[model samples]
Target: MDKAYRFEGTYLQWLKEELTGWDRFPWALFGFGVGFQLAILLLNPINWIAVVSFIGIFFGMWCTVAMGAGGYDSEGNRVSSHAINGLLGSISVIAYVIINVSAGHYWSVLDQLVFLFLIDLPLLKNWRTWSGKSTEIKGLTKMGWLYVIVAILAAWFVLYYVGIYLHDTNPLWDALALAIGGTASWLCFRQYSTTYTLWLISDFVNVLLWFTALKDGYSQAALPMLAMTLFYTATAIVGKINWRPNKVQ
Candidate 1:
């Protein structure tokens, strides 16, 4: 296998080998995301808060495309794709925490904490498999299922209270978002096609989450949040179609 790096030839090789054959969907979506978010930031204003929000949104869009590109199918494949998903998701999470703290969306931070392990642990374990360095995944599916249950429970029981403790009235939505997001991320990590279906649900909740922020007068952060909402919708829908079960592979 070619060594993976950002240097001239190596970067191109990794792209061709690991991220090719998914059609031009990821490229187009990535272009749209960067252009749209940059336009939003440029046309409006420039401040530290705005910069952080844009950064968060950029990574958010990246994660969306990565998840779609690395989508899992119901036919017990795509775990390789899911590896990329978790890698990108981890970056998105860190950027998102910055966005949340900067925008005073503390509740979202708590939710991220709850799901952190779900993303990172899988990324570490699955990267080798995706890179063709290993082929052993004994009990991975069963362990993933356990994570699903534990994640949702943690999202609902623990993160739910965090929202309440923060005096947020929308704790229910927060909890549900975490539950869905956590499970959806897990499914992607496990290379399950149903992950996209779950992401659609989470995407809707994410829209609501930002809508709440916009409604609460965090306008500086709202516009980009709304833009991300639309991008995520497209990603989730396309992801489902791109790697569906029984589809021609």
Candidate 2:
């Protein structure tokens, strides 16, 4: 068996292995997007803008992670992951606008979870398995570590944002959390120790958020978020148990 490369200064190698096999990655954006739309449909808030924005950003990140795993075109050229990410990002903007128009409440905890684990987690797990290739992903890079810190801070900040700012109902902080979370998630995929551990920590944070949301009487918004959180937890478990070096050629 090939030795698993230690997680030290190996981002370049990981990037290479990750960039290959672009043509056949199964991205799970469609599922998450669908879930978000349904959440909005069911939550049925008089003001739907905030909820839609939240869902849109969440799913957009979903697109970022799924696409980051890789893709290719008919001619076999590498399809730009950036392009896919950009397109999804644009959709998120439109969703944000819709949220402003709807002026609905933020997504509930359970709703976030459903979108995450149910819709997004499987895609990530499948990507890891299907890729079957593991390269050394170091977590020490300045940007990499920044992502980790930012992800945690983002989660924490959103909670505080919800609690402290009674009038600023824009949900911008939560959007920032999702954005940072998505970036951090991709960075996590590039490494090992930080990858699994950070995800577990993030899952815990989500659970905490669920409690907070529920206690505050936002139970209607908690379902999808909680679902996604659980899915993320499951992904962390699978990753830790099954992760190995060079499983894919």
Candidate 3:
């Protein structure tokens, strides 16, 4: 807690910690996830928005890791509060959607725009400890249901615009992914353990979304999402296995 998970540690050390299961938060796996995205971005013929999304995801993931490791109470209960990560990540997704829509890549990003707007709640709260660290992670709260409602509305909106801006023939799955993905993101900001579970479902949908894009000639764009999906699957598994109640609670 004093050092915010000591993010400054050497790569070898981080790797060793992950391999040996010495680190509680799976920093090594998360780090690998980031690296995978970075590689895909570098190798692909991507635009600036893609790069921006990468930066957003990079900063968001690392910030979440830091915030998670940084926050705690006197009894050592892990804090669930955060702001910057949620903001950065949502913005990243927005940029991704905008670029994709403008480029006519697919309706996935366009469809996902609805949920992205709600992700700002975490930033609005800016929950932190008196020491300027994170606070204990709490349950889904009433907000979880709100996310569900928002997702549903977003899904409907996606379907409504399908014929207008989208031509996917069958965008049902993509819309489902966006609905769930947006909720999953919101859940993560709320520090709900269930976020990983929701994300697992979302990630699977994303796999389909990107794969569909690849089928439609967006290979470079799809690759990163695919790579991220694989890593997301891994992280979801790890997160669920390691989840626990607040130490203080």
- lDDT tens digits, residue span 1-249, model 1: 113512234433544444544446677888988899999999987998788778777766776676556433333344323345555566667777877666566666765764567665565454543432112222234566577667777767886787788876567666777778767756554546667777788888878877887887754777788789779899888777655544211
lDDT: worst 10-residue window of model 3: 126-135
- C-alpha local distance difference test of each model: 0.64, 0.45, 0.54
Question: Candidate 2 — which residues are off by over 4 angstroms?
Answer: 1-40, 43-58, 61-83, 93-200, 231-249
Q: Which residue pairs come into collision in candidate 3?
A: 79-135, 79-136, 79-137, 80-136, 80-137
Clashes of 1: 0
TM-score of 1: 0.72
Q: What is the lDDT of residue 184 in candidate 1?
A: 71
- The local distance difference test score of model 3 is 0.54
How do the residues 8-110 of candidate 2 rate in per-residue lDDT, one tens digit apiece?
3344543444544453323343355456556754676634443664566575545444443434433353322322333344454455435323333243222
Error of 2 at 195 (Å): 4.9
Backbone clashes counted, model 2: 38
Q: Which residues of candidate 3, in runs, are more than 4 Å off?
A: 1-25, 46-50, 63-76, 80-83, 102-116, 129-165, 168-170, 185-192, 241-249
Better of 2 and 3 by TM-score: 3
TM-score of each: 0.72, 0.42, 0.60
lDDT for each residue of candidate 3 in 1-249, tens digit (9 for 90 to 100):
223433344545433332331244556766777977887787767787677657656654554343233234334544433234444456556656654564354545654454455445444333231122333434454676577667767765766477345564336666666667666666654456666677677778777766776677644455665666666666566555444435322
Whichever of 1 and 3 has more lDDT, that candidate is: 1
Residue 230, model 1, lDDT: 78
- Evaluate candidate 1 by giving its C-alpha RMSD to the native, one decimal: 6.4
Displacement of residue 242 (Cα, Å) in model 3 is 5.3
Residue ranges of candidate 1 with Cα displaced over 4 Å: 1-16, 70-82, 113-116, 124-126, 131-162, 246-249
